[model samples]
Target chain A: MELFSIILLLVMGVATIGSAILALTTKKTDVAILAAGAISLFASIFFLVLASPDVAMTEAAIGAGLSTFLFFVILRKTEQNAEK
Target chain B: MLLSIENIALASGILLILIGLLGALTNKNIIRMIVAFSIFDTGVNILIVTFGYMPGRTAPIIDGAKVTAQNIAQVAIDPVPQALVLTAIVIGFGVTALMLVFALKMHEKRKSLDINDYTDLKW
Candidate 1:
């Protein structure tokens, strides 16, 4: 179990960094927002692996779910105004 | 040196913060900056949670027959960091919301996403 946990942490670290890079370098706001969501989701997994389930759930819900939804809504609204 | 779980998580969290700072510094678009800031916030929260982690302990919550008053001191990690991260998450959300609102207004006024386009405050 220790080995398994270590391996999972390493993989999650790589994935989190990849997503952060994508969020940083992407030109499209949509993709960037999604990447930010990915980062937080991976962090929540980190929390879970570290043995904090409640924090994991809150981070997943607020950081990943609500924040991403809010970003998309703002993007959509601005695009609509631009078209009008 | 041995690579423990905490060290690995700590490294990742610090790397994330650095990446977010780099993005925020180099990105000119307001929305992108907001995204970068959110990434930074997550990194900080990760660090906080990592700080609270114990080597062989689980969560602070008691469920079923696993954790009782007698064994909780031995089994559970600190609960303070969980609460700290929760507050930090809410504050981060508020900060992002405010930034987005500002970005939206700026975009509406300038019709441009680039930071260079805004020179009204330049002296």
Candidate 2:
């Protein structure tokens, strides 16, 4: 079980780093936003694996859901303003 | 030979912090920087949780049946970091939202997302 947990943790770490890199390097702001949110989601899972379910739920709800939606709203508003 | 889970978690947390710092530093766009900041925030939270972990320990919940007064500390992980992370997560969300609003207002005033463009306040 420890070995399995270690493997999962390593995998999650890689995924988190990969998504963060994508968020940084991506040209499109929307894609970057999504990738950033993915980092949060993955981190939430990491939190769960570390025996912190409360933090995991909070991360999922705020980091992935609320933050992503807020970013989208800001993006839309900015784009619309730019068009005008 | 495999490294211990604690070492693994710590290394990963450090890597995440470095990655976030790199992203935050290299990004030119306002929104991208804010996204990078969130990444950094998540890394910090992970580090805090990882630091609180104990090998072979369960969650910090107290059921009063399985986890009694005598063995609670031995069976459960630390709760302080979890509580700290909970507050940090909410605070991070609030700060990120405020940053996004600031970005919006900046765009409204300058019609650009590039941080370099906001040089009026710079000396």
- Residues B13-118 of candidate 2 have per-residue lDDT tens digits of 7877888899889889999899989888998999999999888787888888887778987899999999999999999999999999999999999999999998
Give the distance in Å from residue B94's predicted Cα in candidate 2 to where it truly belongs: 0.4
Per-candidate TM-scores read 0.95, 0.95
DockQ of 2: 0.81
Report DockQ per prediction, comma-separated: 0.81, 0.81
Model 2 B-chain TM? 0.91
Fnat per candidate, as a fraction, reads 0.76, 0.80
The 10-residue segment with the lowest total lDDT in model 1 chain A: A75-84
Minimal lDDT window, size 10, model 1 chain B: B56-65
Best by DockQ: 2
What digit string (tens of lDDT, one per residue) describes model 1 on residues B48-104? Answer: 999999997888877758988788989999999998888888888888888888888
List the global CA lDDT of all models.
0.90, 0.89
> How well is each residue in A25-64 modelled by candidate 2, as lDDT tens digits?
8889999999989989988888888888999999999999
